[model samples]
Target: MQIQDLPYPDPGVPDARSGPRFLVWLGRNQLGGQLKALVWGLLHFLSVSALPFCVGFAVQAVVDRSGARLALAGGLLALCGFGIALGDTMLHRAAVTNWITAAARVQQLLARRTALLGSALTRRVAAGEIVAVSTGDVEKIGWFVEAVSRFTAAAVTVVLVCVALVVYQPALGVVVAVGLPVLALSVLPLLPRATRRADFQREKAGRATELASDTVAGLRVLRGIGGEELFLDRYRRASQEVRHAAVRSARMWALIHAIQVFLPGLLLIVVVWQGVHLAREGRITVGEMVTVYSAVMILTYPLRHFTEIAMAYSFSRPSARRAARVLSLERATDGEGSREALVPTGDLYDPATGLLAPEGRLTAVVCGDPDAAGELAERLGGHTAESSELPSALVGGVPLDELPLDFARRAVLVQDKDPVLLSGTLRELLDVPSSGDVSPAEALSAAQCGDVLDALVQGSLDADDPMDARITERGRSLSGGQRQRLALARSLVTAPGVLVLDEPTSAVDSHTEARIADGIRSLRQGRTTVVFTSSPLLLDHADRVVLVHEGEVAAVGVHRELLHSDVRYRAVVTRETDDEAAEQELNQLQELEEIEETA
Candidate 1:
């Protein structure tokens, strides 16, 4: 497709077996644009090559004392100049279009891969590396794609010029023809060194980017713990390492450039020296000598493209490889499983943990170990680390892994303990793909975040509408409770078939938590909801409570029933040891005995 038809309706499946293969795939996909650029480039370079011949003819005409020949030569010269201008302009336009379109296509492909993988992408690949691939590496890949056409035109024009000179004047032509290839091959030995240095620099830069990202993401926590300075120092060292690697890379490229300049100058001297000797010996005339000298000078111009192509390949190779590495990652569920439509309206079960949450009920999971709870929550939502050894969580009788990714996502929505709120208008943040049954305002009230709505409306210039208020990235500007409550509202608005919430009200106070728990029961009535929490406030409101101990379901019953009947369950939910629980139980018994005596 042409550049105007860009943002390809589909970026197509990439052959990400290797970086070089990926780059080749990109070039093949954009062959139409590349050919367009090549055609324009040929016109431009051919016009330029013709200028030396026109000057040679003009000199010959002056020597012959023929005004007619002079006029003809001048006319041809002007016509060639106009062709050069037109060709150069169009060539640039075509090349740039190729560049932008290739970059856009790669970007679209990356976006699609990211969508398919979701948070798993970052888990498998570094956030920094992904960022580098999408931002800097994308441009490098485009540069190589665009350079191919121009390099082709330059090489073809160089060959044509060498042949024309051989036909017109073989004695000096043979020398140039042989020397041109030598000049082009001179930088081959240094290319590997340059490429290695560039790779190292890219790696260091990626690490520095990752470090900076992590530091910023945890800046608030770091300050509270007084460790920001330590991270800053570490980042400074990373930046220095990046700088040193860059300088080394630049040195190698600089040396290659120096050879590019020095070798061409040497070739020009040899051609001019031989031409002068021929002129003095009467083997060739004065005009012929000038023509040969000017031709060599013009030949140096196209020869420079040889080094440019080398540099482009060197830079883009590593970038394409990194992009390929990222695209090669597959989601945990991306297997050869049937994507048949499955309308699962029964209980959600995790066979690995033997945990079951019945349909049309609010089930509260009490896990004292936060990490285990998090892992269980992920399983309940059909998410786990890349391993596929364990059977996937099932909805009804169908495995979530067998269902299509989009359908599974719609079927179960999981809000982790730390739910993130992205930067946007309040309205935009809540406008997720949802069932459309729950309004944003109703969700907000259900989340007990009415105060958050008030704060946004008052802080915003558009005071009349809280929905218009903008949130900073990760809702960093708001308090922890505000961000948590806002994220809860957004999740409630989704109104999924099964909602898995992990400590959804951990950041809020007891009173607020109680209201949120009641709201959740009211809003999610007659729907399956699994909440992983130890808070008595939320567990007290659950239709049924399941206790998980040591990665297995230990007990399941009503909240009060489990609290009184199972000592382990009571210890977990109450955040106490069995000894402490018994001591408290004994104190209660003694108080009852004294009350009976007083009565």
Candidate 2:
């Protein structure tokens, strides 16, 4: 539970029942740390609560003119001061430990969930929401967790002090006791309103954050489209809405603070007024009156904790709820399969769509709808959206989902249409868990990335070593085709038993696409390769081309056979009429001859 022992071996699955329940679960999970915080908090609050008694005793000693009593009072005061200093220091240490540990536990859980869900996480939850939950929301949850122990200790101190007062002076104690509960409970009615406003503010803030993230991610695209002003205005308006919602939330909380301050002030007034009358009428001594006044003033500190704890709970509840929602998202393959590893070396067959990529064959899937193609590509790698009800993809007569996740991943690598290249040196980017069959040079060559490497290293200090050149975030500094090729190169280096590529060369030129198509076929000569593409150059290179129409296989043949036989296939792959197709074919032939003659 200590900071040094962070990243718990088992950050255990969180209870995703509800917000309040999740918070309770967090407290339960860290019982040992919480107990330490509670003990220190109790000691700290007890020392604070003893200050009034020490002063009251000292006042009585002075009135009695007893040197022995005065000395005893001074000793008690010194002890209380020492306890306050030591207890406060230790309490702060324990509370901070609790906060850090709680936050770390939450972060670990989030990271595990993110890793499990992978790209599907962003599909299920906003990237901004994930960012918010991992950052600000986690801190808020930890703050509430850390505050609970202190709040409990403060409550205990308040009760113990009130009981001691009742024993010391029943009449004034009754007045103080009655007023204390009223002070604590006075703001309860306003809490619902404050919580509602706070939730609204959080909602608005999340939207604003999402908008900002989206805007920044697409800034380059926005500038290209000349839509920067439009997005900027949209973000500005979203930010303004967040500000307005926050102001509304603050107003409600301000009212609650006013009530917290006002009620305590009223209680202090009542205790002072009642004590003065009792002292003047000889019902209580001067020292007793001073004691009652001091007790009421000291009680205010603990009373403020009541409102603070409420505020903490209100903010953390929604944050916890969001975190729980993310944690609750179970992967489609989760809990439905065994942990047995399988080295799949057979065709990847999707029973739902009846699309099969035969083993050791370069199969091209041409789909009329790009969305359907993407889904099929995911299916080829045992990845399905959370909403998908499709049956498990099978390989070697074994369900891919039934295999251990690591085994399944190692067996089939799916490079999505929009693959991400993380910020790192080129060598680090290609350094993935692999079968060690393909070298960096071989993979890069198969991916047709020679031009990309040259571009990256052209003006760099490490010009001779392109692999050492740094890549910016998402490879944003690279061209679209360069990024795609780099992603393809990284995937090729893994050298999985099966590789599913979705539009691997869509961003590249026809000549480069032709080279990549040929290189891929040569590199993956004895492995299963499924390429979802409609490009003629890529389709022509496939050993077998399957035409997918309306989510089902419409035809299966070589690219040329399908073009001549299937009208839908031709429409999809060529995207031209009869005359246009003939004219394009003639132009390509003439261009090839001219290139051959010049060479």
Candidate 3:
């Protein structure tokens, strides 16, 4: 693929059977670019190899006192210089293109895989591991990919240079040619040790990254529980382990580099020594001695590529493996059933919990077990695993798991308890693939986020419009309630056929909660909406409230009726045990509602 044609329309199905296979697949797909790079690399290294011949011819011309031949040699030297310059420049360009394109392709594939798996991807892979794979690992993979062509060129140049030296003067040439292979192969014994150290360092670094991610994600909670220093100390230990491992890894590579430097220098010294003896004995010309000496020095340049390619492979192998592992993960619903968009808008039925939110109505589910509630919420949106042991939820008459993922998501949008707000402008955040039924203004008004808009404008440095103002990553700049309200507004803007919200207003005060409850009921009129919450404010607005006890629907009725009728429902909703006190609270809330209605 050309550099300009980056971000391929489709990266194609990857061979994720193994890390090595994946890397091979990447190279195969970019064979054209690799070949282009290889050709340039050949041109560049071949030009470099020709330089010593030009110098040897010039020296011979000088000794023979032939000015014409000397001038010809000068011309050849200039030509070779031009070739070296041209080839080197183009070779670098081609190699960098290959690197960037290869990295872009991998990123696109990873992004596609991420989209397919959604939240489940993180459940399977650690957040930090995923981060490392996408960032550092991708670069390493690209490094190896780009290094291949140059290494091939370098190897070919070494072989050609060795043969030419032998043909010119067999005595000195044979020794130099034989010694080159030994020099190249000498570092092989040290590679395994270096690779092991590198792997150890990579492991330590990955652990440290994972620890830091976990610590930052829960920084707020950590401070609340006074565990910041404990995590800090743990991270410090991990960081030190990473440092020590890196030092060990560096030491091994240092030895390899020393060997590379020392062996090449040794071979150079031997070649010069033998060439001088051949000159003294009149077995080889002085010009030949010069040629042999210069060629040996020139050959050392290509030899360095040997160690470089080794280093590239050593680092890239593990990176490719990590990327392969992530790509290999399949969504739980993948290949479970038909891949057709056959879902119809209707009631959401979770067979596992026997909970049904009827069509075109607001249904609130109160589950004492928060975990069970969250699971049920996920099931309603076809987020179940492929395991047949866990039954798929249904919509209309068809099982949600049987429908296509895109269709299921479009049909039902589930807002998690702690829904995330990604960084963007208010306009961008609300810019979803909506049904066009709800305008941003209407949704914002319904979500009671006027204050959120004001906050955005107030926080901005230049932009007066909240929609133009930038939101920080994860909306860290906003209050929890603000984030929740904005998320709710975004969900409302989508105007999905069925909207499922789990404790969407948990962070907001009761005053805002009651208004949000009214907003949800009003905006979602004639649409199927399922809310998993125990807040009486929200429950009271639901057309039907289902109380879930022991993972099953225990009771179903209007909120006020269930409050007085079912003891478990009352206990779960109000968190009150005394019937008298529960009624008293309910009465007070009823009075407030009446007064608001009168106002």
Candidate 4:
């Protein structure tokens, strides 16, 4: 495929059986491109292989003192030159096209998988591993794929040259043919050791990459805790380990290279010695001996490709395996069939925790464990894995999982505790695909993001409109409270039928959070809204509060009623007992009396 035809409409499902199997699958998928590369490679290698014969003929003509034959030899040499030039150029073009197209196809598959898997992709694979696979690993796989054609052409050329040599002079041809195989096979014994070292190097490099990614991701936190040096030192050691492993692997490859050179040189010496003996015995003409010797020398180039192809395979095998592992991860669903949209007019019910977020009401969930609360929030929005044993979340009493993923997501929006803000302008960030009933201004006001807009306006001198102001990656330039509010505003703009928010106001102060809680309730008056929080300010504003203890719903009632009746609820929401409250109140009164007496 051409570069312009990129981002294939369907990258198509990969085999993902094993590393070698994946390579085979890639080759199968790009048969036309492979064939093009093979044809070009054959033409190129054939041109190269024909050169020794031209030289042999030229030498024969010179010995015979035939001007006509010499002129013919010159013409053949010119033709070979033209063939070499055209074949080399086109061969490179074809090989590079195959490499690029293969890489692009794999990249598209990765992109599709990432989109399909969403947040679960990160959970299953390390961020650095994913990065490495997409970047370096893809290139390695492409290298092997591109090498296949060239290796095939080289092998064929070697065989043809050997046969021609045998026809010209049997004794010299047999010696060269037998020795060529020895030179190629001698490196086989060293390959296992080299492969082991390469695998070790790859592992170390992956670890180093992972460490660097994690360190960079948490750089702000590391600096806050004054632990940058600790992390830096850890990264340093990891990088050193990677370097040492690479050096060891290089050493093994170097030995293999030495063997490749030494064996071929020995083979050339044997061929020359044999040819000299034949020439002395008058069994072969001087020109024929020269041809056999030149042919054997030319065979060296193709024979070296055997070792090169071996190296390419050795390096690419693990990379392909890693890529296959990533591509093999399937979503826990059928992920096919009709995607009928859900009717946006029902209570969100999770059978796992027996928690029901009723229609047109604000339901607050207070779980002792934040993680359980997050998971429950996800389930309520129908984001649970299809493989989960828990029953599907119900919307309007219909199974959420039974509906298509796109439909389910549209029907229920779940804003995670740590929501990400993609880099874009304020307007772009709020432009989500949904019912555009909620204006950006209204959503921003409800989310208490007025200050965020003002900050953006103040930061960008060229921005005539605050909505046009740019946001940095992950909203890193903004404070925690501003980022949280901005994310909430973006979510609100979607205006989904059911909104499940997990600790949406966790980072904000009490006054700002109180405003957000009240604003959300007012804005979503006739919509289903579930807030997973333990904050008293937000819980008190909810129509109904459900307390989740362990993994099940422990209590359900108004926030005030729970505070008065359930000690566990009080402990979580208020984090104080009645005795402590009384003690604090008495101490305040005593302090007031002491102040009056002093006055």
Candidate 5:
């Protein structure tokens, strides 16, 4: 396959996608609104153009000694002001709308990509990176998009002003026209450094955001370990780094701003100086000179904005690059799994680990590496990948990639260890995205969540519609086990053809874990289920067990059989037992001893 056809490597590069390409992609989605905004911006710019011409006309009228010159000049000024106001309003409204909508659309598109990648996004991307792109970078991209119209309008305004001056009087106009280019172009020399400074500022901001998210997600654990202060200090250090970066960035911007103001003022001096020379030489009328001076003074408004837009883009470019990388993230697809309604009345095979679950049976996965187990679980659920011809992993004899995405999702569901439980009622939390046809009672029974529901009723949700009871955000109030069972119960309610659960019973007591294992097995009867775990209580319920070793399947049999046959599985499962506590430090040595004994 050609290189362009390949997915982007996880390069950790800034502005992940090329700038021109990203704009083209965005344009396809927003060109219409952008065009409309541009049209309005031009009209507004034209309205302002009347400023220079009217001044010149008023001067000529006064000089010619026609009708009440002052009154006519007042009327012209009012008319030009009215046009300016009308154009300004339209320009402002259109530009702002274009920016907000463009940002929102990009937000929606990025969110969709995140959903498509699901948990995989967190796996491949850092939490800080995602947080930065979604919150800060998105607004910048929108700002840049909106800035396009303003930039165009400013250019047109410059042209109109120059042309008017030249038309009124050629020699005077020539100097003004040529002089304005020099003023506008002066900022160009300083832009690169300014852009670089803005980019540095953005990078610091993203790092700060990343550090904050990490701290929050792990705050509880930090508190437990008494490392809160240590982490706080680390965050302080990170904050300091960001502060330094920000200061450096601000210095560059400060210089740019100073230059922006200073250059235009200098340009004004040049125009005024040349105007006086021409007026004294009798090459241009005094009135003409006054009008020219007035027009040149006004040029600062658009010129200032032009430089600012460039400044905003420079600061925003890094963010856009970050956003592009996220938007471009591809959902790894599994090549296996049936696309059609997975009746799933047959065996589930994972060639990657060589684990096969006979149709209508319970199978347990025992792995040395938790991550490997999780990856296997994802594959078994029919998510796709690029590394394999069979895609990432297969389900029900179909490549997950080949299966229509929705069908694959429904056919096989992977319940992660730490499931995200959005705030909602006990019932609402259990039923995600509207679990309409399924009764809450049935799901509760399947999940063994009656106690959880009862407890919430005793709390602030202590009202009618207890099932519709409000949950604290992220289910923070719920115990770890409750959350796990709730997640499992929800998965059970979905009743996917193949259920791949990663450490579903990890948080519960042994007694509870045992019950959950049985409940899951009974509820999933006549369906395929793969449980990634080495807990003896859960393992005992499996019809068969497969041990994943170094990313591949090493041994397969009944759990009891593997306990005797697989030393690694035994070491992992029993390593946490109370009986093994005394030998915990020596477990590695003990495992080696056991292997030697077996040999």
Candidate 6:
């Protein structure tokens, strides 16, 4: 009944545990509700089991021709009918209530896992995959949970009906009992192959969804490079492959469908043919023969569900597996030590690079490999920047892994170059994490986004309210420079102890980037700031620059000192810069790289 009992046990996962086993665990945990629904469902089945016997009684009463007895039998039949209707409605309602609560618990588990993982969710799994799990897979798993009760009900109904018929008329009852099972079990032979095909189809569908999501997320970049047509062609080919996979799955299901429909019909024929012989031999009364016939006819209804429940179960398994896998990913390391012990009021250090960002000081990292620089920035933030399995950095005197998660997160904030902007007005977007004390105006002024704010209504809450214009997803409505600036502004507002920025102004023009660089250093005075940029203007603002060569720090000094001394650093930072004054200073470093290469 509690939220903790849901299926999701891990945050980032592709669990290999079979779906059936998982369901058994859930059922065990919620045994009370499961038992309640099971009882009600059985009662419903028994009420239905009374129907065939009632029909036989009415017929036998007519044959006997005793008016009083006939009236009594008819009244009994009516009473049975009322019981059936009432039991059926109540059982259905109880089963449905059980399912809703079961599903709610699962949802709560998934939600809790999401919160535990935070932004790390996207690193471990695709956004589309998460979307699919929460929307489609959750529903299917819930459906499977509810169907368990219905299946149980149908099974009980069949068993009780078989026992009743055997007691009433041995010869005809034997046929009814045996024939019904054959109808129910017939679909079993086809289920595995059908389910295998369905699994393949589901995998392909997930792939297509992930691909579409990736394409949409990077649509702007693709559009910029003139490769939209090429990407579209590849996506079209993938789409066609998915279509073929779907077709194969559908054909298998079709075969299963055909078998389920025809098998019961065969069983019905056999039961009826045998019953006629028993009646002719006077082994059973005419009314008893009618009862046997009615039982056989009604058995098919539950037997049909036996096939259907199997099919639903087969379809639901793959979806549950998909959801479970996504839910099972290991969370990034969070230290369990005392919060105060992990709290950093000092420097950040990376052993891998042999670099230390001394406390409350501006530090810049310039690397020939931009990726290494970005990654270094992320580890220093106390989390993996992306989904790689790299070791993290130490903050103050302790390894980040030894710090309490909430404290580590609060102490270090990583501001990626392409920071996401959710749909909201400029002011609301600026106030990420939505604190009551921080003013939007102060954040904008710090981000140097006054012009952006003016362009948006002075303080309007909307394109609707005039102060808050909703940005399109990822701030698609804003230019790249504007988005970068807004993201910087948002981070500045937080004012965490360590601000790690990777290529903060990579997308902006020289002039805008220069102003941004100028504004950032002044605003972030007396803070431990790491800017991972090759931009000369931005590099100039750093109090000290550490040149990362390959995966290590090649050199460390002021921007001018590194430019004069480190050639590899020069070749990178000088790229696409128009800082006319630093030309001689830049080329000197480039010449050193050429000399080093020749040597």
Per-residue lDDT tens digits of candidate 1, residues 1-599?
Answer: 66778779989989999999999999999898889988998888888888888898899899999899999999999998998899899999999998999999999999999988776677688777888899999999999999999999999999999898888889898988899889888999899889899889988988998898878888889999999899999999999999999999999999999998898889888988899888888898777667777887887787888878888888899899999998888878844447676556789999988899999899999988998898888878888678658788998867888888888888888998887788889999999999898999899999988899888887778658889898889999888899999999999999998999999988899999999999999999988999999999999999889999997899999899998778788888777877898897888789889999999
Using lDDT as the measure, name the better of candidate 2 and candidate 5: 2
Better of 1 and 2 by lDDT: 1
- Misplaced by over 4 Å in model 5 are 1-16, 59-65, 68-72, 334-345, 384-392, 433-438, 458-464, 550-555, 561-569, 576-599
Per-residue lDDT of 1-599 in model 2, one digit per residue for the tens?
A: 78998779999979998888899999999888878878888887888888887888889889998889889989988998898888889889999999999999999999998888777788789888998899989999999999988898889988988898999999998888778888888888899998888888888888888888877777778889999999889888998998998999899989888887887788878888888888889999877888888888888887788888988998998999999999888878854358565577888898988888899999999998998888888887888776888888888778888877777888788999999899988999999999899999999998899988988898467547999888888888888999999999999989899999999999999999999998999999999999999999999899999998998889999999989767779888877787876776677689889999999
Question: Across residues 1-599, which tens digit of lDDT does each residue of candidate 5 receive?
Answer: 11232222321222236654675456555576667767777666666666765677677787787667767777977977787787788778877776777666667667767777787788778898998888778788878888887887788888887998899878767877987887778768878877776777777778778888988877777877998899789889888988888787778768777876887677678877887888889988877877777777777777776776787678667877887778777755632423454433457787766678777788888887887677677777755444545544555565566666666676678898898777877666666643254455666676677777766777663566667677777676777777777787778777766778899888888877777777887777777788888899989989888888887777888878777655667777777564564355466578989999999
List TM-scores for all candidates, in order: 0.95, 0.94, 0.93, 0.93, 0.87, 0.87
**Candidate 6 has what TM-score?**
0.87
lDDT, model 4: 0.85
How many residue pairs in model 3 have overlapping backbones? 0
Candidate 5 residue-wise lDDT at 413: 82
**Tens digit per residue, CA lDDT, model 3, 1-599:** 78788779999999998889999999999899899988988888988999898899999989999999999999999998888899899999999999999999999999999988877677689989998899999999999999999999999999988899889889988998899999999989899989888888888888898899878877877988999999999999999999999999899999999998898899888988888888899998888889888888888888889988988988888889899999998867744358555548778888888888899999999998898888788888878754536788788867877777788788889998877777878888999998999999889988999899999999999888878988887887888899999999999999999999999999999999999999999999999999999998898899999998997889999999988777788788878768766676678789989999999
lDDT of 4 by residue, 1-599 (tens): 87678878888889998989999999999888888877887787788888888888899899999899989989988998888888889889888888898999899989988877777788789988998899989999999888888898888888877787778778888887777778778989889888888888888888888888878877778988999999999999999999999999899888988887888788778878887888899988778877877877777777778877888888888889999999998766445514455454688888888898899899999987887787788777766664578877888887766777777778888898888889989989998886988999999999998888889999887897989999988888888889999989988888889999999999999999999998899888899999999998999899999999988889999999988767778778887777876665677689889999999
Candidate 4 vs candidate 6: the lDDT winner is: 4
Better of 2 and 4 by lDDT: 2
After superposing candidate 3 on the true structure, give the runs of residues whose Cα lies further than 4 Å from its correct spot. Answer: 335-343, 386-388, 576-599
lDDT: worst 10-residue window of model 5: 1-10
How many clashing pairs per prediction, in order? 0, 0, 0, 0, 18, 17
Backbone clash total, candidate 6: 17
Superposition error at 179 for model 5 (Å): 1.8
Clashing pairs in 1: none
lDDT of 1: 0.88
